[model samples]
Target: MIKRKWSILFLLGLSFASVCQAGGDIDALYSRIAQKDIQALNELKALAKDNNAQALAELGFIYEYGVSVSVDIPQAIKYYEQACDLDGDYGCFNAAYFYEYGIGTQKDITQAKTLAKQLREKINLSNINLDKKVSER
Candidate 1:
């Protein structure tokens, strides 16, 4: 059993390494982002998974403020929630703020309050569990 676990870990590690390496001499998708090209931003974002904090945060900002894409507050909140769960400070702030302001989502004082408190007290905040809790209630 232990050997199988090790094998699985090794395979996953190799997969991640290959993904990082296969992107061709390290692409500079950031350049297109800096140039304010929304289509390029979309393509680059597709390359990085939404769960990745950096990607999530960038996506959040882009959607939230219409930087390189259409204004999509809900999409911003979704990405911020993912990023914050991964220890992104900016994500925490953005998610909490958006929740508080009732942007994209119906305003819920309880959720907003809980999120605000979470940001102040938790080092890393992820809203997936919180959303589950709210749904259950």
Candidate 2:
């Protein structure tokens, strides 16, 4: 029993440590992006793409906003959908919004509402702490 408890604690600690490390890089990336350093941003993006939900969501945002890239709504939709599938709230919101607004897909209110509900349910299961934000999205 003590061994099991120790293992759990170790895992929890590691999880916290990983999250903290990720925040530092994310901050640095944001700063680079703010400075409009395209080369650094691309390098940071490659670093991010391997290991995070945020990376995928940021990819979606970049495609959506055309930050240092061409605006391609279909590509934006594809990236957002990828992040949404990975349980990202921002991704879910953007995906549903694009679908709702007919940015890529045809506007269909019923489909939008349905996807919104599905995203909320999935987000609830994956990120229980932010369930309230689901409705806001």
Model 2: per-residue Cα lDDT over 7-48, one tens digit each: 999999999999889767766776677667787568656854
Global CA lDDT computed for model 2: 0.70
RMSD of each: 7.3, 5.0
Poorest lDDT segment (10 consecutive residues) of candidate 1: 22-31
TM-scores, in order shown? 0.58, 0.70
Expressed as tens digits, the lDDT of each residue in 14-104 for candidate 1 is 9998767644312455557767866668765775474566667777877888875679999999888877777766787778767666779
C-alpha positional error of residue 83 in candidate 1 after TM-score superposition, expressed in Å: 0.7
Instruction: Report the Cα lDDT for residue 49, model 2.
Output: 68
Off by over 4 Å in 1: 1-31, 34-39, 47-50, 124-137
Task: Please name the candidate that would achieve the greatest lDDT relative to the true structure.
Answer: 2
